[model samples]
Target: MRITTLAAAAAFAFAGSLALAAEPAQAIRQNLLALQPDMPIESIAESPVAGLYQVQLAGGRQLYASADGQFLLHGYLYQVQNGQAVNLTEQAQSKAIARQIEAIDRKDMVVFAPAEAKTHITVFTDTDCGYCQKLHSEVPELNRQGIEVRYLAFPRQGLGSHGAKTLASVWCAKDRQAAMNLAKARKDVPAASCDSPIAGQYQLGQMIGVQGTPAIVLADGQVIPGYQPAAQLAELALRAGK
Candidate 1:
């Protein structure tokens, strides 16, 4: 889980020429499994770079491995063309976020929206995060501007912490919206427990590069990492929708 860049470089330096006859994806999986049998590999696919494959690991970590599976690069991948450097890693992550979001049902989200919403954004929020509270306070204004806000729990502390427990309570409450508001306001909601999606949401947040609370995903799968004013967010959402 914690392979240093220098270590990876040394690894590649020693084992860069092991060719494989199998498909790139299968060969990479086999190579990685041989290295660490217990490491969870979620997916493998062709990367933007020729002869390099993008590997998606459990918990959303990504790395680039050579097509032959002998070299691994543990950093961002950039596509340079026409005097510009485009972050190919981020672009791929955005597409993956879009696909994952599409699989989520609205019923699992806590939403605030106008009767006829122009667009909706998904937010990964933590109950104890100050910026998350600031963002929640603007939900009504965002709704008024015809932008729906859907919230998924991303407790800064792991699932066993008080923050996570509080989020679970919010989801268990009969009035989920009110409970969320109370938690955001730093007030305690009645402790409750149920079969909730908090754990899955937290994992999803990690996969989509949500390092902090109030991480907002716009309609086009563009990730805005912090709080934006209601009016500005509404404008951004409308533009992203188009």
Candidate 2:
């Protein structure tokens, strides 16, 4: 009986070692794609923890799945040790946001770059949002401090609403930046129909989990959920590696 028990213990150790040797990147992604066919896979790789994969979706999103494909989790992932939160998922999200923002066309954006710019930030804005307007009012100050601000459309109202109409009008205007300024100042842009990228930007914002106006994307891809003062925003831009 003792001999049999010893053999069982050795077998269990060997099995545990085998599980530890398995690489997360190999097969879990294929299974996750199979499970959520519509969710485009942006990245998949081994995580800090064993038996899990860190999956970053396109448009600054993140999720996790087990190596065996038996389970999936989507939300903020925290590593708790010594009373501290180590967020591996947030790091993945930042990287994802950086990539997506880099892929945006410069022409479609309204840019305010400082002559001595040391940082770049992207803001998802809606003209009609009061807080968005408040944030825009500080753009000039932010730019003066060598922080470049890039605007992406996130109409608070869905498409065909007044906010969307205003965004579309801004895209249609001859001087895009000036039109944006006017809109932020509560002035109307000329209503001229033009094939604009307002829809695409809005969709991208949604994909990135931007649920409100004045959502700022720092250079390092970290998101600031709400409006920040110019000084604070500049500091965030610096930390974002701008």
Candidate 3:
């Protein structure tokens, strides 16, 4: 009788293991959606932390959930090993940002590059922002240091506003770089219209956590919010490449 009881217990344990192992990621997603139907979930994958799954939402937001989808955590997850703490969340976000940025064609950007470009940075810029104007003023110096600067429009005001119209004019102008310069100098851009990616770029900026103008995204997908001197930015870009 004891032997039979032991075998039954073993069978139950095996079945439990099977149940845990078969918990589908889709189930977790469904559970999340049930809670927040409006939240845009992008992807789900197993996290470094045991029993936790990483959930990536639209616009680079991240969260963690239990394998069974019973609990969800909304914060950064750190892995501590050998007396060092590594931010797993930031690592994942960086990779996502890199992929999204790579998908952008150079033709869509106002690019300023040196003859021998060593590195490039993408900037989400606004025409009327003071810091963006300051950053644009340093573009010549940045170009001299072999760092290409690619500009994507991100008007602080939302679509259909005056700022957006000005940026759309810049994109529509025959010489985008010249128009950008004029707009940054507070000069009125000639009214022009085209099939522009300004709105998409603005949404992309929001997804990637861009809160202000002149947000610089380095080759390594690190975002530097606000202005940095030309030399300092060049040095940082070079170091990131290494």
How well is each residue in 1-242 modelled by candidate 3, as lDDT tens digits? 99999999999999997776657577788899899998788888888877889998876679899887889899889989899999888888877787788789888888878898888899999898998999999998998888989999898878878889999999999999899989989999999999999989999999899988889988888889989999899999888666
lDDT of 2 by residue, 47-98 (tens): 7777777777888677778887667888888889899998878887888888
The CA lDDT at 199 in model 2 is 94
**Per-prediction TM-score:** 0.80, 0.83, 0.88
Model 1, residue 91: distance off in Å is 1.4
Model 2 C-alpha RMSD vs. true structure (Å) is 7.3
**Residues 1-242 of candidate 1: C-alpha lDDT, one tens digit per residue:** 35698898878866663333247778788899999998778888778777888998754468889877889898888989899999887776667677678679987888887888998899998899999999999898888888888999999889998889999999998999999999999999999999999999998888767899889998877899999988888899999877
Clashing residue pairs, backbone N/CA/C < 3 A, model 2: none
Cα misplacement distance, residue 79 of candidate 2 (Å): 4.6
Ten contiguous residues with the weakest lDDT in model 2: 20-29
Candidate 2, which segments miss by more than 4 Å at Cα?
1-34, 79-84
Model 2 CA lDDT for position 231: 87
In terms of lDDT, model 2 sits at 0.85
Roughly what TM-score does model 3 have, to 2 decimal places? 0.88
